[model samples]
Target: MDTLNSGSGKLVGLSFEMGPIRPPSEGGSYSLLIRVTRNCPWNQCTFCYGRPYDHEKFQMRSVDEVKADIDTAGLLCDEIKNVSWELGYNGDINTQVGTALIRRMPQLGNSHSFINVFNWLHSGARTAFLQDADTPIIPTPRLVEIIRYLREKFPSLERVTSYARAKTIFKKKEEDLKDLSCAGLTRLHIGLETGDDELLWKVKKGVTAEEHIVAGRKVMEAGMELSEYIMPGLGGRAMSRQHAENTARVLNAINPDFIRSRPFTPLPGTPLFDVYMNNELELLSPHECLEEMKILIAGLDVTSRICFDHFRNPSYLNAPGQLVHLLKQDYDGYKLPEEKGSLLEFIEKGLRIGEEKFLKTESYQL
Candidate 1:
């Protein structure tokens, strides 16, 4: 069974193991996920649920193990390419339409369901995401090799992204970052959860605001698309102002390609949730979150596309629409920098509408 069967099972004998998930944008864009690392190196962010803090050890898979995964995925992609060509399904081969093709192809009904993902992949995915919390910690040379090998296998892929802790990226030498960017690692997603040092300390976010800027600038200098995540309610009520203002200032400093606002919602497993329960940390009401967001937007000066979003998007192919549409980013369909006056006015109006108002714009954060 190591060889692929056109309509039945995988061609390879080694079963692939999927690690933690990714941002919804990846799914919407039909980006395939390849887990290059296991769990996060630092999982102490108060709002996080990554492994080191909860379960699992921080470990890096050997290059050979990763290559095996790529090898298996490559065979699957190759099979899909051939079958798609044979079937005359010539549409741009991303996952969504590819799945549709599989469902329509009655001949494959007898095959295992898992095999369909590879078949779906055949629609030719040009984008992929290296996952589980962060992968930049993968030694730069090995990381470069992995990226190069992946590109060789999936020649059609135009970009590959992986989450990188701001500290991890900051630790890399300038030349390594530049060379890695050139080696096919197209984008870096850094969880710059809060750019305010005070709040950063409170949340145990390891890196400071200056470090965030340092890492981000290096990514841009290396010509890699950087998506920096900012959590709106992370400061809660006590430090809300600093959270918004400093975050904007930092964004201005780094000017990442995409500033994705992941609205703060303290989940049960995280330390922040315990703080919320004890009333030690005041959670931001939706209205308060809106107010903080307003401050952040007003202070932002970068040309980066601001995505008022998190992972839980509503419909397929639909980005959890922004507070207002602005400039668009090519990687994951982001909107940024709407007119300040009109945007604030719109937000104020939404605040007036209140929690009773069920809107995607207000509840975009999860």
Candidate 2:
């Protein structure tokens, strides 16, 4: 009564999903995502799917198990290459090229990219992502060994990255992070969400505002490129102002190399989802979110680059060029592209005059 499909060899290796919530990082994408571990190590987050059904017992596959998955992936890549040539497509004739191709094709939506496939097929994967939430929580030497193995297995692997928790980074000795970085752990992505203390607690982030700043500095100091994810509207309807101001303060302290804006969306199964459905955690409308962002950008003191990388966010202020517009004026005299006059005139018409009439004008959406 074995229900698993073991005979076909079709679903043998580590598979992956690139879906609505999670996507690959900027500047780089993965062709193959070998899931060395399953489910998140920390499932207490108020917003997440846990990836796997139950997350209490975090698991790490043995070296042999991961190698077997890699072997299967290699075979899968060979099959794909044969299929490609049969279809008259001439690519790199190597695995990395195969991986890059797999990513471009839309039909392979949920599967790991060809790089992952070919890496598995040829020398074994060059780069690997330690799955679940906090892979850095794994012992440093063990992570180092995994990285060293990956480098030896695939000589082209210039980088290996992982999802690191702020708490984990804070607890680790600085030497350990540097050691891991030396072992080819090139980058770390930490979800900073918001810098506001109240909002952090409300979202159940389990880290203090100071902890975020301290942990971020540590990562950069350890010689690893750090990308911090920030959620724009996590504070809900009531705390929007506080959220914006506090977030700015936190970012000012961290001065992260990359500040990525991810507009808050409550997934159905998460606690935030329930909060939205029951009207407990009222979301700020799009306009209000923009205002919050304006406050955030205006408050930014550090010259670190910011990126509005996620597609889900609709506000223009987050994009690369759009931030310049926000910098052009104070909040009072802000003008949109369609507006005809200087922002001062609009402010005068609305604020100075008894003109409740500007609301009828096309400038404001709220």
Candidate 3:
């Protein structure tokens, strides 16, 4: 009776809808996403475009709503398995056919939405991400229940993660965080954009540098892997050096499990973009940004792994000549303290290339 086809009255329709965003790491994980909250409660970060948070009012879903999402995701797994069997798939659906099957879903209509489910199953759904930015800000008890219920329904799921605002994570008691971790909240992606208080205020990040350090350390202490996203040129031309140095200082304090390098890409819609347009915020050219990134990498004294995986970051070594195009990663990712010198060398080389690429990029932003 746990099956979708078993008259559960839970999602009579086979189709499923997930929130608009997930961490870049989760994109390839085929992770089941349960949107516990509506939009961001604090969507004021100027560098952020947490869509549809940009246009929608924020709201929290009830416990029942969250549970229903888990149930639906569970049923989806069941239906996908059923469809695979019907198609004579002996526990393995080829990627090519799985892709083609997805393409033909509309022709099959809602009645045959199992094709959609089959696509997921073929890809090996092994993880889950609680979506719609910053779920850790949700009440501790409610979040605990949601995590527990999600694990119960998808017990074999490998890991569960969610974005946590430093302000929210800092406010939660240490004991509550440990409880949440025990309840299966394994990872957290925090946007510690910069360690400069002035930049934090300018971006409206809602947390100071000290709180960011505290919240990040708290996550690690509670047995959660922390991925701190650091923007290289968030301070723009004015505070670029301070941004890099202060960010390095903060990362050294937390020594987070992962330091994600997110080079600044001014969105045309945000206040920062307006600041750039009005010449109030002197934007960092590709060379300056790379130099800033070099300073950041050279200054980092953490044992954390660094990932220059975002497309916005220039991949000096790997991509060869995409320095200004906003199109390549230097490498997959690197474990810091070891690859530190090499990462800096790569960035330094790119800085020497001295090309203004971002200005030439024709709208990579959607």
Candidate 3 clash pair list: 315-330, 324-357
Candidate 2 clash total? 6
Against the true structure, what is each candidate's TM-score? 0.82, 0.70, 0.87
- Comparing 2 and 3 by TM-score, which wins? 3
lDDT of 1 at 100: 45
Q: Put down candidate 3 lDDT per residue, 1-366, tens digits, no spaces.
A: 111232222223555456677777776565666789878888788877554466577778888888886776667666455544545565465654344344444443353334434444556666788877878777889999999998887667678999888999999999999999999999999999999888898888889999999999999999999999988777888999999889989999999998887777678677777777787877677778777877888888989888877776664333354334233343237887998777777766666653743332124354
Query: lDDT score of model 2?
Result: 0.61
lDDT (tens digit, per residue) of candidate 1 on 3-71: 323552333332455565676567656676777888888878887856332557788988888888888
lDDT of 2 by residue, 215-270 (tens): 99999999997777788777787888888888889878877766676667777567
Computed on alpha carbons, the lDDT of every model, listed in order, comes to 0.71, 0.61, 0.74
Order the numbered candidates by lDDT, best leading.
3, 1, 2
Best by TM-score: 3
Between candidates 1 and 2, the lDDT winner: 1
Q: What is the lDDT of residue 212 in candidate 2?
A: 91
